[model samples]
Target: MPSLINDQLPPVRHYEAAPLTKEQLDYVDLPTIDISSFTASADPNVRSQLVAQVRSAIAKYGFFYVLNHGLSTAQTVRMFDIADVPFSDVDDDEKKKYQSRLKETGTQQGYKPRQYHHIDNGIRDQIEIYSLNHDVNKSGHPAALRPLLPEIEQFAYHNHVNVLYPILRLVELHKWEDMSESSGHTDIGSLTLLYSQPIAALQIRTKDGSWKWVKHIENAIVVNAGDAIEFLSGGLYSATIHRVVQPPADQRAYTRLGLFYFVLATEDVKLKPLNSPILQRRADIWLKERFQGAEVPTMAEWRKGRTKSDGNAELKASATNLGVEEEYLNGVLIKHYV
Candidate 1:
C-alpha cells in the first residue's frame, strides 16, 4: 500500500485495542431535520427556523439526517449505476488508466485504486474511490466517464446552493468491502452530503468518547459538519469524528457502495474564526485553546496540508489508539483530532 503522507509516513506499527465500556458500545439516534418546509415555504420565518435547526445539530452532534432533500430515488440510483461501471464492471487494466497520481496533479480529484493503507488499522482499506471536483478542467477523471459528468455536476451544484453557498465540493463513489473499510477521521472540508446504500457500516463517535452506528434511513441523505466548518464557526460547530467499520457478521456476504458529495469553503476564503453571536458570548474558548500557539492557515493552505497529512502514522499514534479525541463546547461533547 502506498502512503498518502509523503516522507512523514511512519513505519508499520502495532496498535493495541482499548476496551470499550457498555455505554461506548451502545447506539444513539442521530437528529433528523426535515428541510422540505424550508425549500417549499416562501416565509422568511420558516427559513430561519430551518437554519436554526441545522445550526444546533451541527454544533452539538456534527451529524444529522436530512429528509425531503428533493433528490428522487431514480436520480440517486442512476448515479450508483454510473459509479458501478468503473469500480465493479471495468477490467483492472482499464481501470488503472484513471488512477490518480497526487504528486503529479497536486490534488486528490481522480480515481484512487484500493490498497491505500491507514496507520490505525495497519492494513489496506478494502475500497476503491473515484473523486470528481467542481471544476471540470481541474478534475483528472478520465474522458470515458465524461458522459455521466453532467448529471453528476448538476447534483453537486444543487446541493451547494440549496444547502450552503460559497462551498468547496467533490462527488465520490466508494466501492467498499462489506467488512473492513475506512478508519475514524474528520473530513477536511466544511460539510459532507452522503447517499449511501442500504448496508449500515458507518459509525459516529459520541460525546462520551464512545462509538455508535449511524442507522441507514432509506432515501435520506446523511449530512455532517467537517473541520473547515469548525474553523469557520470558531469551534461552535464541531467536525464529527466518524468511521466505516466492518458490517455485522450476517452482512459479510455483500459489498457496500457509497456516493458522497463533500462540501467545503471556497479556496481563497480566509478561515479565521467568524464573529457570530454564538462565538461572541462564549469568548471562543475552544478556538483559542485548539490553536493556542499555532499560526492559522488560509482555507487553501489548510486543505492542501490536510490532504498530505492524512494517514500519518505518527500523528495517529499520538492521538488516541482509535484515532479520536473528545472536547466539550457549550455543554455539548464534540469529537475531534481524528
Candidate 2:
C-alpha cells in the first residue's frame, strides 16, 4: 500500500468565521484539581482525599484541568518557543529533511505536514506536527531543540510517576490554524497531557451530547483519560471525546500551538478490568457490555493492530466505527450497539 504521506501538497484553504451556536456560546467548564497538596502533604488522609477527587472526575468527565504541576509559566513559554522553530523559523526544505516514514516505522514520530484528512469532516486540515517517541533523546531531533530536552524530559517523568504510573513517552509539537484542526475522537493511549498556548480552540463533548468550549486557563494544563484507562477502569472512567476547532472570530488570526504528552501503559499490561471494589461491584454488567463476549487483547497486540489500521487508509476506512471487528484489535470495548 502507498504511504499516507503526501507526495504533492495542496494549497491551503481558509474558512470564514461563523457565529457560535447556542451550545457553543455557553461555557461548561471541566473539573479543576489543585494537585500541589497531593504531592506535598505526607498525611494519608490528605492524599486519600486527592485520590478520591481524581477518581470522581475521571469517572464522570474523563478530563480535568491541573494546577500547581511544578512547571512554571516561563518554563512552558520556553518549551513553546523551542517548538516554534521547526514550523515557523526553519525553511520548508529543512523541515522535510526530518520527515518520517510512519508506514515503515509503525510510529508517529518525526515531521508530518498538512493535508491529513479529518475522519469526521473528511476535509484536509491545515496543520503541521512533529512527534517525539519514547526514544526521543536517542532520536535525531534538530540540534536547536537539544538544550530544552532535559526540562521536557523531567516534566514527562514527573507526570508519569505521579499520575499515569505506567507511560510510553510520546510528545508532539502541533501547530495549526484555528480554521482547520482535529475532529472529535478519543485518544488511543492511557492518558494525554496537553499544554496549550493561551488559545481556546479545544472543546470536549459533554454528557448531554453537546459540544462545549474549554477555556484556556493561565498556568493550567489540560489532562484527559484515554481508551486504555477506560478499559482498565471497566466503564467507571470514560475516555474523553474531544476536538480542536477554529477559535472565535475575535481570535481567528492567532495560530494554535499545543504540546501533547501521550501516556501509555507497559506493553505487557492486559486490557482487562482492574479488580477494584468499584469495578468489581458492576463487573458482570460492565464486562458483558464492554467485551460483548469476545476475549480481550494484550496492550502490545492492540497497539500493533491500531497502528497498522491507522497507516493504511483503506483498512481504517472500512473498519467498524465502534470497534466491533472480527477481533478486539483496539483496546476499548467492541460493542455492537451504543
Candidate 3:
C-alpha cells in the first residue's frame, strides 16, 4: 500500500498530529466490537456473536468502535498522507476550480475551503473537506489528486462495499448533544464510518443529555447510526448527536485530518419507515408523523436540500424549539443548536 502512494509525499502518522494529555484522555465508555470473525467466517455462531454485540451497542449507545474490519495502520496512514496533499499542496485557484457544487448540483463532491460553514456568534468553521462521491469519474478533481485516484478508489470501495455492506445486512439488521466547533446536529445519511484521528475534539452526547469525548482507538473505525437508519427503524435506533471542537492546547497547532464515509440511501427511495414489525413497534410518534404524508421528500430531494441548506444556514429564531434556530430542506424543518 505504501508503494501505491507517491514517493514525493512525506508520510503522515496519526500519533504525530497531537498527543492528548492524561486529563484530556477522558472518553466516554463505549463498546468496542471485534468484527474480523463476522467478515471472514461463514460460521453462523461466529456471525451471531458479532451481531449480538452490535445489536446491544446500537440499542444502548447509538455509537461504537469497530476493530479489524479489514483496514490496516499503514493503509490508514496513507489516507492522511493523501489528505494532506490537497490543502497543503494545491493552490487556492486550482482548488476552487473544483469547489463543492453542493450549492448547485446538490452533490458534495469536491473541495470545500476552510471556514466554509457558518457557526454561531459570527464564528465560521475552520475545517476544509474534499469529498468524493461514490462515482469517481462523474466530475473532475484537483490535478494533484489525479495521480492518487487509484489509491482513493480502492480505499473508498473497501469502505463502501467490503465493510459497510456486511454490517448493513446482518439481521436486515438491527440498528449526542454537543455545541462546539462543528456544533450539535444529526447526520442526514444512513450510517457514518469515521477513521481514527488522535485529536480529542470529537464528542458524543450521552443518554443523560451530557457530552463526553470519544477516545481514539488504533486502527479502529468509529461507526454510528444516522437519521436515515433511525427513520428506517421507526426511530428504534437513535441518531446520536455529536460534534467537533478545538483540541487541547498541545494539539491545537496541528491540523486535524479526518477520513469519513457517509452512507446515504438512493435518490428515488421514498423516506418512509420500513414495514419491519421490530421497527414499527417503536414508540417514536414524532418519527411516524414526520414521514406520514405523501409530501415526504425522496432521498434525492432530501439529500440535496440537506447538503445545500447546511452551507447556507441562516440563523433565526425557531418558533418550535428553544436554544436553537431553524432551517428547511424540501419543507422539512432542520434545527441547529445555538
Candidate 4:
C-alpha cells in the first residue's frame, strides 16, 4: 500500500494517448465539386445541374469536400503549416500580449473563454480564438480579421469575397471556434469551413448510427451544414454530427490548429428549398421526407448537459437565444406520442 508520506511515492499523471496514424485515419472520399463547372460552363444547363447537385449535397449530407475551387495549391500548403510556428520563437512579448489581451477582453463574443463547458460533462477544450468580421458595405475593404494572424489574413479575405462569396453568397465569418478536437454540442448555422492542418481526427456521425472517422486530408477544405438548414428544409437536410476525437492512446497527435468558419445566410434571409413551394404544397411527402429513418437528437437533446465553467468566468459566452427553434413535425423530437 502506498504511504501518506510525500517522498514515498513519485508524482504521476495521466496523458491522452496518441492520434490515429495515416493508415488509421478515416479515409472519406466524399463528393467534390469543381467550381469552374459553374463558371466556365458555356452551356447554361450544365451549370444549373452542377449547382443543383452541390446544393442538394449541402441539404442532405451537411458535409462535403470541394475541389477545383479558386484556392491555389501552394497557398493551401502554407495555410496548413503556418500555425505550426512556435509563438515562443517570436518575441516572447508577442505571445504574452495575446494571452494578456484575450484574458482581459474576453473572447471574440465579448465573453471570457473560460466560462463555458464544451459539453455539460466537465470536458475542458481549452482553446483561445478571435474573430474577423468583414463589413459588407466596404467593397474593396475587408473585415477586421486575423490581426494576430496577419499571414493568413489576406488569404481569408480573398477567399471569403472573390471565391466563396460569388459561389455561396456568405456574408461574414462568425466567431471562429478557438478549439481543437473534442465535440460536446452542435449549433445552428448555415455552413462551416473546417480549415485545419493535417490533423487526422475529423470524426462524424456515420450513416449507420455510429460515430466513425473522417479521414483528414492535408490542405483540403471541408464544408458542413448546421441546424438552420435543417429547420428551413424542415429537416430534409442534415446538420451533421461531427466531433474531434483525440488520437487514440498509442498515436500521440499533433496539436490541431484549425479554424471552423460558421457561414451564415445573410442575416434577415430565410432559408427554403428552391422547390419550397412545391414541397410545402405536398404535405404528406414533406412529412414522409422529414422522418425518413432513424431519428437523431435535436440541438436541445445534444445540449442537455452543457453549463458554465469557472476557470474563465470573465469570458462567459452565453448560448444564442434558442437559435434555430422549430419542430420537426411528427419527428422523433416530440414526446408522449398520442
Candidate 5:
C-alpha cells in the first residue's frame, strides 16, 4: 500500500509492455471525418463538405472519429509508452510524490490513483490517471518524463493547433460508468480527443439510454463534444455521456491505456449561449431557465469548482435537489446526469 512517510523509490528509467491482442466486439460505430480535408485546401467545396459532415455528426452522434490528424502512429504509440512511465513503471511510492491536490488546486495535472473517484454501491473507481496541462513547465513531473518534455510539448501543441483548430473551424464549432472503472458523466470542456489501444471497456450512452462500446481504431482520434459546446450551441450539439468498465473476457487481463486532450474555453469566457440566430432558434425553455437571472460562471470558476467537487462524498450525497444532481458554483447551478 502507498502511504505517507514513505522513502523515495528508485527513479523510473523506462516502461515496456506487451501489445494487447485485438478482438472483434460490439461497439458503437461513430461517424468519422477527415480533418485534413478541411485544412489542406482553401477550395470552398471541400470546406463545405467537411463542415456539413461535422455538423451532421455533432447533431446526431455527439461523437466521431478524426482521421489524418497529422500525428504519426509512432508518435501516438510513444505517448502511451510515456504514459506507462508514470502509471506503471514507477512504484506506488513514486506516484505518491505527485498525487493530485484536488482540494487545494482543483486541477487534474497530477497523479490520481485508482479508487480515488467515488462510484455507487460503495465501489471506488478501478483506474488511475495522470494528467498534464498545456503549460508543461508548471508541475514537477516524473523523472522519466522530464527528458522527454520537448516531444510531449510538441505532441500537445499538435493536438491543439493542428488537430483541434481545424476541427474547431468546421463549425467554428462545436464541438461512464463504471461497473465500472470510471463513472458515467459528460466531459466539462469544449471538446475532447481520445486515443487508445484496442480495448473494449469504453462505452457511450445512446439516445435510448443503453451503453455501447467505443471500438478503437488504429491511429484515429476519437472526438467528442462537451458541455461547453452544448451550451454555446444552445443545445444544438449534444454532450456525450460515457464511461469505462473492465475490458471484456478476451482482453480482461491486459492493461488499457488512453491518451486524451481536453480542450477548454479560456478562463475569461462566459458560459452562455452564443448570439447566433440558429442557436437562438434552438434555445429551449430549460436552456433559458439555466441562465435567466443567474450569474454564469466563467470557465475558470466552473472548472475549478467542478474538479474540487468531483470526489467529495459530502457534495456527491448533496448533489440531488428535486431529483436532479447539481452543484452551485459562482451562483450557477451545474446539473449532472449519466
Candidate 6:
C-alpha cells in the first residue's frame, strides 16, 4: 500500500540484457487458452476442470496464453504504438549525462541501457522504463530516487503511471536484480502481462520439456508462472523459462513492446509443498531440486523484504556451482532442475 520513487531515477524492476541465440531459442513454446471459456462453462464442475487445466499447463510448461482476457484491442495497440519510440539507443551526449548518476548513486547500478547493450540497429526499441522497489527512504514520496546512471525517463512516464502503478503492487518478490544481459531469469510469481499483438519473438518452454514458439495472437494475453508459483504450488505448477532473441546480426535492439505485470510476495515466503495429496510427492522432489541454503521466497514475501545491497553476492558464489550464466533470476535453480 506504500509508494516507491527514487530521487535521480525511478525504481527499475525489469532488467534488459543481451538477447538469446537462435539455437538456444529452439527450446520452448508459450501455451494458449481461451479466457472466454470461463463465461461459457455451464457447471461448477466444468469451471473446476478449467482451473485444473490452467494448473496443469503451468506445471508442465510454465507458460500459456489466455484468449478473451478482457483487455481491449485499442489499449493493446496504443501501448505498442507508444513502444515504437527508440529509447534504448544512447547518443554521445546522452551517454555523458547518464554517467554523472553513476558517481552520485555510488552504485554500479545506474541508468545503463547503452553500456549494457552496445548494438544499435536502424529502428531501436522505443520502450523506455523506470522502476522503484524497496527503498524505505523513498517509500512515501514516490520520487525518492537512487541516482540515475546513463538515462533518465521522460516526464511523460507519468501519463501511463496511473495504469501501470497498480500492476507493481501485485509483486511478491525476492531480490530483484537489474535484468541487463543476453539472457536472465525471473522469480516465481504470477505474471499478468498486457502485450502488443502486432509483435513477434515471444517463446516459452513446453510441456514435454521442449521449446516451442508462440507468436502473438490477436486480442489475447499470455500468463505464465514464475518460480514462486512453482514453489508455492509444490510443483503442481512450474516457473516457465522464456527469452527474447536478437532478430539477426542485421537487426536492432528496438523490438515491439512488452509490459510484464508481476505479482510477488512481501516477505520471505517459504516454498515446501502444498497440502494437496496429489502434489506432496512432487513437492518433495522439487525440494530436492533446490540447492541447499538457497534463499527461496514466494513473490509476495520477498518483495517487501528486499533492500538492494550485496545479499545477491552470496548467491553469485553459489551460482558458479550450477554451470549457468550468472545473471538470470533463477540461474542456479534452473540448472539444478533442468
lDDT of 1 by residue, 157-220 (tens): 5666554431122211111111001167788777788874666578888898788888767778
Candidate-wise lDDT, in order: 0.61, 0.61, 0.72, 0.45, 0.71, 0.42
The residue pairs found clashing in candidate 5 are 176-183, 176-184, 176-242, 176-243, 177-183, 177-184
Query: Highest lDDT among the candidates is held by which one?
Result: 3
Q: Encode model 6's per-residue lDDT on 183-257: one tens digit a residue.
A: 334443444354524334655545444445655567565666665566666656556666554444422453445
> What is the alpha-carbon lDDT of model 5 when measured against the actual structure?
0.71
Model 5 alpha-carbon miss at residue 319, Å: 13
| Model 4 lDDT per residue over 1-338, tens place | 11112343222221222244645554555666666676677787886777676777675556777666555655554444443332213343343343323333322321123333333246566554433333322112111222224444455555455445434632332222211111422444556777534546676665654556666554556877775556455656667867666665444434555654555444333334325565566534544554554344342222221112113322323344221222232242321100
Q: Taking the tens digit of each residue's C-alpha lDDT, what string does model 3 give over 120-178? A: 77788888888886556667888877777777767766776667766675223221011
How close is every model to the real structure, measured as TM-score?
0.78, 0.76, 0.87, 0.60, 0.84, 0.55
Across 166-233, the per-residue lDDT of candidate 2 in tens digits comes to 11222221111110011566776777888745556777888877778777777777889887787777
Sorting all predicted structures by TM-score, with the top scorer first, yields: 3, 5, 1, 2, 4, 6
How big is the RMSD of model 3? 5.3
Clashes of each: 2, 0, 3, 14, 6, 54
Residue 313 alpha-carbon offset, candidate 2, angstroms = 4.9
Report how far off residue 199 is in candidate 4 (Å).
Answer: 1.4
* Candidate 6 to truth, TM: 0.55
Measured by TM-score, the strongest candidate is 3
Q: Report the Cα lDDT for residue 53, model 3.
A: 85
Error of 6 at 56 (Å): 2.7
CA RMSD, predictions in order:
11.7, 10.1, 5.3, 13.9, 7.9, 10.2
RMSD of 2: 10.1
lDDT of 5 at 338: 38
- As a whole number from 0 to 100, the lDDT of residue 99 in candidate 2 is 79
In what order do the candidates fall by lDDT, top score first? 3, 5, 1, 2, 4, 6
The C-alpha stretches of model 6 lying farther than 4 A from their native spots are 1-30, 39-42, 81-128, 132-188, 192-196, 205-211, 248-254, 266-268, 282-285, 291-323, 326-338
For lDDT, candidate 2 versus 5, the one ahead is 5
